[model samples]
Target chain A: MTIIANAPYDFTSNDRQEDFRGAMLVYVGWARHMMFASPYCWPLPPDMPFGALVEGPMAQAFAQHPDWEQADWSTATWTRNGEPFTPDLSKSLADNGLSHKDSLMFTTPGLDGIGGMGF
Target chain B: MDIAVTKKKLGLKERYALMTRGLGWEPTYQSVDDVFPMDSFEGIKIHDWDAWEDPFRLTMDAYWKYQAEKERKLYAILDAFAQGNGHLTLSDARYINTVKLFINGLAPLEYMSHRGFAHIGRQFRGVGPRVACMMQSLDEMRHAQTQVHAISNYNRYYDGMANFRHHHTYLPYLQVPRSFFEDAASGGPFEFITAIGFAFEYVLTNLVFVPFISGAAYNGDMGAMTFGFSAQSDEARHMTLGLEVIKFMLEQDPDNLPIVQKWLNKWTWRGVRVLTLVAMMQDYMLPKRVMSWAEAWEIYFEENCGALFRDLARYGIVMPPCVEQVRKERDHLSHMAWCQFYQARGTNNFHVWLPSKEDMDWLSAKYPETFDQYYRPRFEYWAKMEEEGTPFEAATPPQQCQVCQIPTIFPVAGDPLTRAEHSCTHDGERFHFCSQWCQEIFEDEPEKYVQAKLGAHELYKGNLFGDADPTAEDFDPMAAAMAFLKLTPEDSGLHSDSRDAANFDLWRGLAKANEA
Candidate 1:
């Protein structure tokens, strides 16, 4: 039950425990799912303050925002071995249980942002 | 002669028993291990071969009669479809692209299954299972041949419909399926049975076949529908064999449970990964969508897989690993794949385009939660660019997954512009995968995947088009790529802006005029 920190920009290190392979793969799929849906969420206008919210509230806000349209937050209710995982987006992915060495499933919002399915 | 003629006809049970267990006995000349070396390597223990049950009890004579009758009916429909110019009746010309995907991606895998089942039929020690495998081997061959015959009708009118078997061998996108079957075929006997017999046939074949048939029925392509219908009966038998094989292996010994579970996980993921093509076809290619890929996945996988896992729980097996990932991905995969094809048509052999406004609305309705929000803008962006006379197509090939060979376009969840690249160092060389499952697959058997011929690597190393320098003025990478595929512009890869788009517009214009 060791909890690893998340680092969105880094992927050099990842969890390789034999027992965690299945759950780790689930997280990887979630990472891809989020990246795919990120384009729908436009960058906040320059002066707006950036904030992180729990997935339940974020989903509601996204649904109401006509511009955001039908964003999928299925993976936003993230799970670790079928248990719910809520990470703080305000901090680096490492603070949220994603790390370059152990877990690589977060996004660095400004510098690299997210790479898309469209190369 | 008169006395001998008084013998009665053998009943079904007696005939099957004699044909199966009646012929088997312990061998005196060679050790059982020597006789069946392939079975033991996987650590599957079987105390008695007689315990195997031949479920079909289908003799060669009955098999021929059953199959030939079905083929006669299918060929009759195929002949009608061809002779009546039924291609003209499809929902749209773009509908043929779905057929193209089928012929190129799936048909050849059927042929490969034929070879796989044949090999395993000889490899297994039990006579009952051997006979069943032999029957399934023939069924697979028939599926391949009939699929080709049915779709060959399109070859007469379409650009990318020709030379499917050849395309499957060399096409980059097609490598997803080719590598999958090759992995299964090259494995031990039990692995092959579970990989093809169980995971592929029983679990995932419906995802592929159902969409095509229903899509055909909706689009008025009787040829494909007929071919699919003809194959369905045999598919049921193959699926039964798959289920029976798994249950038999599990029931035989407790030690066999974990190994079988591992195979179930490996092959289930592998098979589902390949179904990315079907998902794309169902969601994007068909002119008349039968169901969204998400809904189909829910029916075929989530609901069905839940029941299947419950049944297997008694044997101490859970669901295939990471299947929840597949459940989560159902809403997103088809759209992602369709967008990838639209953007990268230059590197592929199929036609793709931005969905029409109506089609987009339909998608939004079908995927109410995700489409308009996450996927539509991408399509809108592409379509707007096209309208402004600056259509977007990739100038360079995207880096492909080391194992699956798909491009690195899969999104990292929550980030639309960035995708995940999972990699590992194997034998001093770095390898990349599109997802953790593929990466883990490589880690598990680095030897099996290390030698894969990635398209980019091949071109960079000057192994293509007679080793000509990639920088030479006369050298064209696309041409080099096509040269390896034996494809020419006339009858090969269909371009989105080419005749396909024009024909679709033409059909739409006529429909509009009729409506007016």
Candidate 2:
């Protein structure tokens, strides 16, 4: 007879656009290892629909944002547990199948590199 | 004649009793041995198949109907979640990337088990176990389907979930789980059970499932939780099968204990090494916290297995000797292994998904001996590099462990900095690697890991350096695949990297880094 959401609700909400953007940045940082850390970067294999986030139209669509830089990820903007980890972005370069070059940026929350817990 | 009273309609349990215990007919023509031959390969002998106890004695009519109902409930949950932009409510779109990692790295193995259990279903001489496996075979297919469907909701929101069976060619993390299953499936049924059922499902399932459920719960994605819980409830049954099968073998003969021990050691460590991603996922991947790998290992492996083995030891089956080694590794491995992922050239990064200091300090306190003593100081060294405007430079990974394919981040078992990364020579040619695990696996069994004449980066090394061929035509992924599978170059097989076949090289390479 009781609903989980309405049961004396007290959980925090990320309702602001800034919160959403910040969360995105934190996720971007969380994904830092994904870009440069794997043998071949980009989250999925090239044939998968998800791989398009890196190589195809969506990649281009995101690339339209001006805020991103080739090394924007490595720029020490946030900290975790007071121990800083600048998403070792060297993986993002697209040159020589080594790093990424796409410049995709979004506005608001600065979630990337917020120390131990990025979000 | 007086009419006999009709037999009372049976409840589920009574039906389970009749269908399982009474339905199987005595073979009029063939002996049980003639019907099944795989039981003796690991030299495990069972005196009696009837003695095997199956707690969930599912009969066919009820089995099919319950399975149908479970599926109906599962699909409805998925539909409601998708109809809702439940995707956006998730911690972030990137969390879906973690789910993507789960699918590419882990899902195919579920499908493979569908075939594996089908074999076990038909081949087990015991009617009880065979029937259990038959139901399990069906469960495996449903698991594979549900896993894909659960993540497909993110196909529009993320990139990694799409056409991923083919993604093994491009993503190295994906290659890790794929190659592991490929090797397990290629081995005998006994090895498959050791590698999959015991090592993966029984020993490692809690560590995996806990993070998975919490990830769904924290992100507000009920669909994943429903699917995960369904698959996991079935997994509880599979774990029982693993334990029963192992005990059945041990009960058959005393010699079976040693063989099972070796398998337990090898697969346990291998499984743990691969689960490093889940380690990072629990520790750092989620925006909200989940149980740490250290805590999970303590409860799942230490406490549970400790008790299980204590029970087994009474039968003269000693506990797995490697338990202490595993307990030690769990302390520093998530940190070390995640670093391997962070530092390896083609591995995934832990950037945007960093955890908090309270969590890190908690990590340090929990793993005081390992973290405070070894890993923390080491990261400090790297931090010094980044602060000096020169985050420490990484070298090209040695080609040998390159077979294991993880960076040399894992130091010798006890020493974190000794960096014993080395190579061996076969016929005057040198092979290099980052860790002894990778090197020993590669050198002791070269045919196991090496696929001859391939490297996506090879042409650039030779005359093709100037060709501007965006397609990586020359690289072969067989070695990479072997490394991923806990196999090495010394052992030769059709799928091994040592194979001379060109198409094998091509497909194998595609399976690794997706070369054209």
Candidate 3:
């Protein structure tokens, strides 16, 4: 299944960690919130706290959703790169074991998008 | 003494042979393998170049004459349409967004196709297939030219059409088509023909061209309809060449089957993913919809491509495995694509809007199983938000598939509510895909796909902004990115709020009135 090239075909991934300067690319998706269409990718420092993400960018990203106001993060379930995990609110993303391009998905069990159909 | 000399005119078949395969010669100074270096890299076995048949014996002279005649007739109509202020004659101004999508997203691919064909034509050692490729290369170039000419008329009357060439390179949605063509063109000769000629031209051209052209006719766009007509004959030739090339390779050697099958699997998935834009246009953008995207898929992919695969089965080429996933997706592709476009409208060069109630009803009727239950409520909520002066616009870049390079917006199969997310770590770097098929394609060619210039990644990396410092305290990233994409405030937004809509109302009103 290798590429049948005349010569060696090798190259660095264009979006390698170093390409983002000092930031790591983290993708966040709200489970069942189809209104946003897809997960949003943001460049944030690895040292930034997980609570800062939930309060600042993630909150802003999902603010327009009807269920956002009623969303209770303390009761919400979370996954880091599709695996179940609990984040410490005060801990940095790196402390939560997140790396570059890793996806974080959150589901507010009670707040299932607008009209309970995942928008 | 009077001497009379008689010369016999060569018959069509003899003339064709003389003008085509007869033109090739054995190289004296260089080896044949050295000259056609790209021929063998893909591991396709070719025993005899002479066995390659020319599906259509269109020599350079005949090709020029026929195309020139077509050009003459096409231009005359285009000229008449232009002089008559034909832009105002059609359906609603929103119809022009479909044309904008075509010009910006699809037209540039025609140019890419030309380059692909031209490159492969020079690489193939077989005289017959080489000539066929050469003629197709010319046809592709002509198609690019005629498409630009036909659609450019709308530029004078539309906001989005003015910067299409620029948008084709920079727009995130446009990168889907741009990257698709670049992938095909960058592959070896065999892979290129199979990807573009067979998988695209033969299997999927109907889905792409039929909807756009028929949609044009339905919407009173005589100019685009005529362009479709002009290109129809060339497309027929291309399709025949597609079939001929595949059959030729299969008949030449048994070893070629598996390689071709793998490519067929890969390209079929790739082609369908790229056509998400067209699906959105057919379902949402067209004011006078010809058919729903689901209906088009049933006819084009299921019915037509079904027969094509059955025909190809004798050569041991089964229907691509991706079709099962595609069947699951047909009902929802357009909805997902349109929703993505609507939220990210500000970043695009074309306008997007919520489908009218009638449009939704049509969608409900067409997609009986899913539309009303899943999509309608979402659109209704967005409309309500718009009415309340709080419109939804996504400021952040969406996650894009590493292989296809489209935003990973597709919902999980059988579960329409959840977004499908497939990712794998390769060489310690993470790659994401919208579907398993795309991930498999990446897994098969990790080296090739890892080098992909993903648009969203590039945007986040601050590669899009030219001289502006993204780090400057006052600089806005989204605004700077939009500026980089050459999208003006008037160029993109809700269709109702667009300059195109405003101008259409003003101009059409004056055209009907007794005085200005």
Maximum-lDDT candidate: 3
In order, candidate lDDTs are 0.69, 0.55, 0.87
**A8-65 per-residue lDDT for model 3 (tens digits):** 8878889899999889999999998889888999999999999999889988898988
In Å, residue B458's CA in model 2 sits off its true spot by 9.2
Models sorted by TM-score, best on top:
3, 1, 2
Q: Of the candidates numbered 1 and 2, which has the greater TM-score value?
A: 1
Candidate 1 Cα misplacement greater than 4 A, ranges: A1-119, B1-10, B25-28, B413-418, B467-473, B490-496, B500-516
The candidate that wins on TM-score is: 3
Enumerate clash totals for all models, in the order shown. 34, 71, 0
Q: Model 3: residues >4 Å from true position, as ranges?
A: B1-11, B471-473
Q: TM-score, chain B only, every model?
A: 0.93, 0.77, 0.97
- Please state the CAPRI-style docking class of candidate 2: incorrect
Candidate 2 lDDT at A38 equals: 17
lDDT of 2 by residue, B1-516 (tens): 999898878887677767876767778798766667665554566787788778766688877898898899999999998897566566544355457556776677788889988876776677788788888889999998998998888665443355567555444445556556665665556667767778778876767776657666887768778888888878898888888887877777787787677666656656766677677766655555556678877778788878887888866766655555556567766776655544442333112222235556877877777766555544565455455764432222212133434433444456543333355544333444544445544554454454422122221123222333335776444433333333323222111112223333454455457545
What ordering of candidates by lDDT runs from best to worst? 3, 1, 2
Q: lDDT score, residue B467, model 1?
A: 51
lDDT tens readout by residue for model 2, A90-116:
233232131111112222234332132
Clashes of 3: 0
